[model samples]
Target: MTAEEETRTAAPAERLWDLAGRWHGVAVAAGILVLTRVVQILLLVGLDRAIPDPAGLRSNLLIWDGGWFQRVAAGYPQGYTYAQNGALEGNELAFFPLYPMLIRALSAIGFDPGSAALAVSWLASLGAAVALHLLGTSLFKSRRAGWALVGICCGAPMSVVLSMAYSESLFLALVAGMLVAAHRRVWWAAGLLGLGCALTRPTGAAAAVALAVAALVAIREHRDEKKWPPLVAAAVALAGVPAYLGWVGWRVGEVDAWFKIQTAGWGTSFDFGDSTIGFLSDTLTLADGWVPMSVALILLVALAAAGVALAGRPWLPLAVYGIVAMILVYGQAGYYHSKPRLLLPVLLTLLPAAAAAARARPRVAILAISAWAAFGLWYGAYLVAVWPYTI
Candidate 1:
């Protein structure tokens, strides 16, 4: 009945209420994600109906990367090898295991691998939207801003990749989860998520670096740092790299299995200088002829600029992740066409802007996001159904 006791008791209840309030944005994001997935499914179904056998259409509908992932999921890895012209080649080592792993697990329970892959990816995409909402809410200190950020990400052109059997949705979910855990200073969770991210895609390295840097900064700031959570996070995040590398090394008797496979098999070499210049030149030169290429290039520049602008803010984690992501994508010697999808995670930069936008004009933010989502839906449908033929 004392005032201090009442205040203490009330504080916890207030915090719970605040947390509940923030999740409204997550619900809204879920709605948007579901709607987008539904649209994609409808388009796919329509396409399937139009083309009974759909064999020839498959080549156009499911081009390069998607076919590789499907083949891997279908248990045809034996036909694949690490080297391109080294005789053994299919898809075994070329693609990472996480996505296929999910497909396999789902298939074990009687689901078709391809359908399972798509289903798992769809769910992961929803999880990613939720994670983005949470991340934005945490960074901007507003639920509205969080919702706006989720809308932007879900509506972005890259959102179409989520429907595919690709690792983007899975990776995005892991990365976003890692970011949220890091923002809360929950080192163990963040580290675990970081490890999961590494397992998902190459960008996992960027997530690991961002988490490690954040942890180091937290340690340096705390004079009596007895807990050492950040260090724990960094260690956990890094554990996956060595474990993965060691496995690959043991399997192939090479410490550089990953690098070699990446280079030789996928034509992904790390030529920092030429890679950066080529990306810029190609982007500028091809900007007029190709719409996707142009949008990707502009988005890359926008993300880089956003990172720089937000670097001084309290949310240094976002800037760190964005900068590292941009650097990684720009450093790639091949897959230049994928620069847009590669920069998907960097869209986290939009969180800060979303927060500011929410404070100034929440309606404007929502409207813009809606427009983008509409475009993404239309573009994704077109790509799956029509654009593949044109290409």
Candidate 2:
């Protein structure tokens, strides 16, 4: 091949790896995590001071899923039982074991469960940011674009969840890693990551779908002549579903503990048009002060949908993931509060926009991303300050 052709062929891979290996990426990711955690701590402290009653504050600010996680972390699993409303008639099997399991393990290592959970989440958030950077660079073939993508994630509204004791960060990291492996045609790695993601969150099924579709496309384009590892990888990724269900059944005496728990505890049954209409109605009426929040949410949702629609064929895997995730989110009943959290993965939609902008006006893309990051920082700080009351 000619030198120019060779350079062009190798440039994307080289740029991707170089960006992945850089100290700048590491520093930026670390900075985001640190800032987020600091905000969390400040929020906690502020809540404590404002409430005066520590118990009441804890019950309010850090209650719900956070409280349950703390209990699991404290090595008190024997009394563990799911409750619909503080009553122990429900099955604890409904809750996935991954995050709580990690919290328990970390507690065994001498760290408090709360601290351990937060620490793990913080690290996972950083990893997700890095994975996002690499994914963007690979898809866009520009290190600068990758950096901008990472920067945007650092500031994304979802940073609030990343800083908390939630499983979103870890789930995002696993999903991103799986995507990276799929892109490289590393089937086994993709499958393993997908399984891990499944264990982390139920919505992780989206990763398996994305990978499976990608593999199918690869197989068809090659007329089954090429050895496509993605087929096997996709299978491996889906294996987590049965494995997790079996474990939950054995422990909770029900095969659908996870589903039941989500349904009963969170009222998350599927309801497509109703949920969407509810959100839209609320947005229009400005009900529950939904104006600003709705605007932001709509912008994100629209961008994600547009990106998938515009990609035509090259972005099939991402499109599949995005579409499935949106369906899952919007299909749920009583989705007003949780919809934003569920749409966290949709942030990947920004990747195509970042790519298009980088190819056209790289500098403008960088500036825009930087502005988003700044907003993220400010929003995170505000959340920390008012988390006890509003979060």
Candidate 3:
């Protein structure tokens, strides 16, 4: 090659190398995400042999809630959805708009709906891993902790949703980003990311509350200044969930239309943990299947783990977010198996594991995470491939 040509080729490579060097932690986090995804996808493929679906195993990624998201992306209903007998039915409106809107925007660029949905989810998952790494590093001041956080989260049970046509990936990305911004006292970014989280999922309310706590902490520390930025950020975040809910009500001509739809369609409502307790009781005592028993056990372990995390005295904003998110997941009456998926982003439960892994030797950390990824990936794959229920 000519000298000019060699310079051109090497310059791009050099720049890429420089970029990677500057963001090595992020690169590691991304690698962890990719590793977990590969393991999970392979597990799903292996499970396909036992499940035997005409549409193939990959199709399972878009089953259940994915269908709802796709429907919403196609277009939301102009009014309430009702069953043939005139009963209120769960409609596309029950699904959040941010994810579907992203899918639609991607589709407009000429990709098919399924491809677009997956594309949006995968991209958001990447963003999530990066944001999570930043959050961990910012809070703990350790790159190892950041990487551990990414690995634990991506390899978490039901983390397959990160690769699915679901909004959990987007929600996680926004929530993590918001927390990172809040911890860094970047109020503008925090406020916008918090708003995004609120629009993406109902649990965003918990996140907003967490942001408010962070703001209060900041205000107390700077009592003389009376920082308006923190106050404004909290207010902006607090407005998101209510704004979306109100818009839904206005669109459907009933103030409670969204709640009614959720209850009718998914049997989801806050019951002060009554249903969860009942499920745990039955599953522990007389459960017919191992999956139910396992789920029940996970719920208990998660609660205990969160308690331990609190005892460790994590950053206040993160603790608040984790506790409130857990409340929303456990206090609701709904499909019991789905709780783990919702809990995946609850940093509180993951904190104990992540911190332990961070402190361990590299070989030990890798082995522990490998074992965890093996079971978590398999469990998630089994839920979608063979569980025969909407997760």
Number of the top-ranking candidate, with TM-score as the measure: 3
- Alpha-carbon local distance difference test for all models: 0.69, 0.65, 0.87
lDDT of 3: 0.87
Candidate 1 per-residue lDDT over residues 1-391, each given as its tens digit: 6798567535633543375264565578798788777776566566655654653433433455666666667663322263445553333565666777887888889986667777788789988988877777676667776677777776666566777767889999999889887776667788889999877777777788889888877767765544576888877876765676566666766776667667765567777748667656776776745665655565566666576556646466666787778777777776554666676677555655575557767677767767767776666655556444321
Q: How far does residue 223 in candidate 1 sit from its true spot (Å)?
A: 4.5
Indicate the residue-level lDDT of 13 in model 1.
33
Cα lDDT of model 2 by residue, 1-391, tens digit: 6798568545644656775657776576566456645655565466556654454423333444676667655543332354556654333454566777887887888987777877777778888887777777666666666666666665665456776777888888888778876775556777888888877776777878888887887677766334546777788877776787677666667666656665765566777648666666666667556334654465456556556655645467877887777777767775364555567666555665566556657678766766765655555534444444333
* Per-residue C-alpha lDDT of model 3 across residues 158-259, encoded as one tens digit per residue: 898998988999999999999988876778899999999999999999999999999999899867544888889999999999998898999999998889
Candidate 1 at 236: error in angstroms?
1.1
Better by TM-score, candidate 2 or 1: 1
Tell me the TM-score of each prediction against the true structure: 0.83, 0.79, 0.93
Q: What are the runs in model 2 whose C-alpha is more than 4 Å off?
A: 1-15, 19-64, 73-92, 221-228, 290-314, 356-363, 380-391
- Considering only N, C-alpha and C atoms within 3 Å, which residue pairs clash in candidate 3? none
Candidate 2: lDDT of 13? Answer: 49
Candidate 2 global TM-score? 0.79
Ranking by lDDT: 3, 1, 2
User: What is residue 320's positional error in candidate 2, in angstroms?
Assistant: 1.0
Alpha-carbon RMSD, each predicted model: 4.7, 5.1, 7.0
